[model samples]
Target chain A: MSEVPNLDIIIKGCSKNDRESQKQLYKLYYSYAMSICLRYSRNYDDAVEVLNDAFMKVFSNIDKYDTARPFKAWLRVILINASIDHYKKNLKHNKNQELSETQGMTSDFRPDNEIRYEDLMRLVQKLSPVYRAVFNLYVIDGYKHKEIAEMLNINVSTSKANLTKAKANLRKMLKVYEDAAI
Target chain B: MQPYKDDIDQLFQEGLSSGNIPFDESAWIKMEKRLDAADTIAFAYWKLIYPLAVILVIVLAIWLWPGTSDNAESAPPVVTENIETHNNTDANPSSANNESSTTPEIGAKEKESYKQAPEEEDNAETDTTTLTESLGPSKISAENTDEPDVVRATVSENEATENSPSFTGGGEEYQSRFGGDLKILEGLDWMALDGYRGGEVEMTEVPMDTTREEVIKKSKLLFGLTVSNDWSAVGVSEFTNSGPSIGAIVEYLVLKRISVLAGASIGSRKYSAVGEEYWRPRWMDRSPGNEINTIAANCRVVDIPVNIYYHFAPKGLNQFSIGSGISSYLMLREDYAYTYNFADPNLPDTWVWENRNKHYFGVYNLSVVYRRQLSDKLYLGVEPYFKIPLTEIGIGEVDLYSFGTTVSLKFKK
Candidate 1:
């Protein structure tokens, strides 16, 4: 971390519209941003698109960034907004589908379960767009039900209902994974 | 229905937050291209707007300025025309009447005496001499006794009025008829007026050489002291301050109606940064738990300005001048300090000062000066000026626009 260049100096350079500084900043946050984008996007290509859009916005509005606040938190907000914008643009075809309620076996998996991060990401991506957005906004981003509703442009009950359905679907997938492991 | 909600949420939060998922390096290249495109668009808009804004300001300043060609041509012509008309109607008629009455008396008496007896005309000449002496000194000679009566009378009438001490009312008429010729009269000594019924005063011919000399003599050097309050704001920053400035200027006439002025001033302004404060790691300072909070700066500047002023009514007591100039500001001192809090109670309240660069900046100024002459050599004036900086003042941080009203006292020599 000490060997890495100072973020404030890099941000100042980016504020001056320096292309190299922008690239440096993008490379620094690329992996962290990609993880968030992947959860919101349908595929790797869509995630790349979201990442590009969010980074462009960050570079453009670099002047507004206050050095005192955590830079990553500000960047996270921009990426989330980019994701929401991407969702809204493709909303006509990417509408959430109706899912029937499923009853599944409750398995007590220890903390040392063998689920890789890649498997978790795959399962999260398998969820419908609306459920995935709500789940990401509420669960991963720590937004309240009301905030998630506002962000997704849905009511609180719909957000709560979507979170429940998302959790049930994940449980059904986990049950399948557990059965396979046994 | 969803007892495993907490588990699913924890599972995904931990999994996603911790994931260092690899992304294609080509995305940065694409993003850089997009950023470049956006920057180009922004630069294009700025390139268009900047020149347009400058043109608009210059056009507006020229249009609104008082001494512009339109106002100069329109105002002075109307005023001069009225003065000319008044002088022509009032002074010309009265002077003509005075000449008509007095000239006939002197001419008829000489004519009658000459016709009665050529020898006796000498006695009549003595009488005429006495009459002329009573009236004033006459330029008419005895040889003019043979000339035409009207011509002789007109000559005597003009001479009488020119020397008459009582003819103060004809001053403006004399001035109008013989432009700058009265400058000669200003050098002469004359006696007080006694009532003398005489002919109307005639206009005199003025020498062109003396007129130029008098105009040159009237062009005086002016020195002025000004005090003003400038309301200034940093470029695109939500911080502004009103500061006092004091200056002295010297003006010299470069043309008949244009003068060049140069001056120096000193002023100070305070600025504060706008935003929320958060603690970030400080690598430079070894002090424990140092957290940056508020940032503020006070800038002291010295300025030198060169301006060209156009006086609308140079001879009038109420003078309106419009000028434009450039000023160079030397940043004498910039105290840029930021407050930082320490998590340790043992560390007292602390502030760190940052070194500011760029000691000089330039600004363009447009001003309107309205002056009322308090005396022949003293004038009191109010100048409202607008200033736009050519470069940012504080490092790369801010540009400033200043509007000020300066009250000045000027002395002319």
Candidate 2:
């Protein structure tokens, strides 16, 4: 009873679409949701867009939230789905560009030997959107290549290829940073 | 594979797992605005009932109007066959089962029981959420249990990220971390572990003035094709004056049970009446009368009907709707055949073309529609409609009443 004492009330309030409960839910999960979105999105703006969109879905469909499942786990899934939706919606304008052509990824950006969260985020975001999505889905989110392929509407082989490409790019970016630090 | 492949994966998973940005107040404000625009999902009955009220008013007015009473008599007879029956079944099987099994005792039993195959549990990814749970991850709602470090994800593919199917929800470590949902704000006080964190590294802040596409679609559109036999039943003190009409319709639902439809159909209102008192359009020359002269009209018209409808959509494949609105008919082709009453009906001199298709706004149209779902996007429907002319039409300028039942194929978009 000591654990999550008010969570049931909050969930019930959220299910009824109480605005204060919705705000409480959004505030409660903002960090957790934002963390997930940032890993999949390209930048701060895109991640924020994805975050709010996911929250909107959460509020609209709270009644569908099965009481048996862990709420964090459910929220994680929604955030990931919202990120994919954002990616697909902007796929035309944000098609996979080469690392050099990536607009805001600056080579001059430097970090210490022990790369902090910001530096590490830039290293991952430096990968193209497709590669980043594949990496996030497969490596971080524990989705299989087959599952990722189905979610992304790509061939299984294509999913494997994108994961490979994402790893190689991340390795290259980390190497450049390491060489500069040395 | 590169030596750092696994290292790369572990590095990102570990790094991105725990940290969060300061909650931006603007996000909640914007979300509140969106919620305001599209209210919480209670179907507004007023939208559906408004159409019915309007139709009732019009029906009463037509019933009382002495001048138009003669035309109202030609309305197509009502077919009172039951449109909605056997509604005990539901549209979705799972929902039907849920509704049937949701007695309070069964509901309590349901919380303790799951239909999950036991073999599936052996394949559960126990580590999927254990990593995050150890990190004091947020967003939890659960009952207290002695087990502090339970790994709860089940093996269902659709629920790959979901917790144990039997879990009441939340996690012990997760709850202790935030202390409750509201403790996340106070948790932010301890959130300054790294000053350079939370996407603050030279990130470009988008202007608050930047707008998104706010014109989200509030309604769904349906396209239709209609083919029917149209009747001009003013009787002319005679009977059986009907013609063929073919046209297309576009309808969109503005609310749950209310829709506005507008259509343009090319229909002909043809009949033979006594030539003695036949009224002529100004553009036509009065026919040179002969012995035993009578009139036959073969007029092609384009009818535009706009209607507001209220529908009773049951949880089955069939939907029934009632609508009342106005119709405007354009004179497409008018050829008055002047016969000596004994002359050949096809005699060349007996036919005269008076005017081109003239746009004439004429009648009040009412329709009773029945539609069946053929497939997800397509619907098979029959709509029987009647038009009481507000103004007279054609060479006779008679109280030309039109009635028809159209078979239509509707596709929803």
Candidate 3:
């Protein structure tokens, strides 16, 4: 219980940029916060970058420690926000490449058209960056479509539409695999 | 909502399949050092006060408990006095009558009555013996005037005969022992009988039914199987969709409702949901690393159940059990699949690749079981069992090795 109070004191000491205190704070949350960052990053090295960047923010804003909420929970929010910022920067850069719009067959889809589980996963992984992000946030992360639109700076309908396309593409790939296996 | 089912399920599972990324070894060591440097006074106080409080309470209780005993000392004297008075009164009744003239004390009414009964019996016995001797010559009545009515007649004749001394005093002076006059108390002899009495023991025997009519029972287990649209159970829903699974159970009939059964069960569950990704400038190789990619789902779980054809139901078989207990299946192991997808088939074999498997044992359950008899040898059962794995897998050190529920049918002979 008192670890929280001690953590506050430690943060205060780090804000002074005391070399030992700074090292102590860095070492305390580096591994765990980095793991969280890794879950949201492109690779291991990006996770470490996000971790270092989030900790610098934590040190600068040590005065905001409320002494009420858990230190870990607060640290998690900061790390998540940092990872999001990093993701958006990459998203903007990738959008520079012109994408050729492909037309769908525009037919009602049947779910029972047997599909192998493996091929479906490959097709999902093949989705464009924006669609995959929207699909993951909305479907896997349990975020509402509205939250997805707000987070990605896109309209709710766009998020919904992308998810539908992602599923459709996966189903088509799965159908081909299931047929070949038969 | 339409089950919210999507390809994202597949992606999540694929990501988990990538395998547990081991923690950086240096990170744990640094964490320990940081914690050690932090001082925690409140924790120290709590540790000190708890044991101190417990010791004080124990000391207070021992000091305050009652310490002395007065009743144990006063008992023996009362018993000694009662024995001495009881013996003297029985031995000298006439001497006691003369001593009363000297002491002028006849104590209690009951004690005086007890003394009078023994003296009266002695007097009566002497008179009867004299009458029998004198009456022997009474037939010569007229000649009996010499046998005066003031007759000490039989008494006087015996007195002359008793004046003759009998042979006395032979050998050694020995102290009397062995048959000494020790009085036995009431109820003292029952201790041996009490020692032999049996203590409480509950022995129950399940009797066999006279009628050999058979009764059948049944049971089942079911495991939900998940398949990533991506071919795994580890990552995002955008990546995985589970396949269909089906299960059922049955048992046979024996005496006293005991049944033996054999049944097989099968099912699958998907794990791994795809997650958001970021690029590390340091690790950027192919161009500026400017694209967002999904973390592929990694680990998934699938259950394949085995059938033990002659397994008897676990209950009621004990009613007429010839042996110790219920005989049932001893589960060997859950089947596992260590599957990997070549993210880049063209890459060399040694290229860094995402590793994951459906072989994780850490999901919700590991053991397969049958419920009680639904009919005869037929039983319905479910076990949400778990196994602590012997090896490590996935992003964590422990691989969730085997998991699933069983819906089975058991057949008996």
Recovered fraction of real interface contacts per model: 0.43, 0.40, 0.06
lDDT of 1 by residue, B273-375 (tens): 4313222223213354465555565666677889898876333246678999888877666554444554332221222212323334378889999876553
Give a tens-digit lDDT track for model 3, residues B1-413.
12223444655545423433345646434433444454332145634543554454344333322121221121111000011111222343222210010111112222333345435556332110000100111100111122222211111111224453321110000001102222111110011111111111111221212321111011122122111111223322232443333333333333322333333233333233222221121111222323223332222223332222223222221111111111111122221211122222111111111222333222222243444332221223454333334333333223223333333322222
Per-model lDDT: 0.57, 0.57, 0.35
- Stretches off by above 4 angstroms in model 2 are A1-3, A96-109, B1-6, B38-413
Evaluated against the true chain A, what TM-score does chain A of model 2 have?
0.90
List DockQ for all candidates: 0.21, 0.14, 0.06
Model 2 Cα lDDT, one tens digit per residue, A1-182: 21256767888998887889888988888877888888888788788889889888787677765554456756776787789888878787766455542333346556554566777777777778888889998877777776577567789999999999888877777666665666
Quick one: ranking by DockQ, best first? 1, 2, 3
Report candidate 1's interface RMSD in Å: 10.2
On the 0 to 100 scale, the lDDT of residue A166 in model 3 is 62
* Per-candidate chain B TM: 0.44, 0.45, 0.23
* Model no. 1, DockQ: 0.21
Candidate 2 CAPRI-style tier: incorrect
Error of 2 at B274 (Å): 74
The alpha-carbon deviation from the true structure for residue B312 of candidate 3, after best TM-score superposition, in angstroms, is: 99
Docking class of 3: incorrect
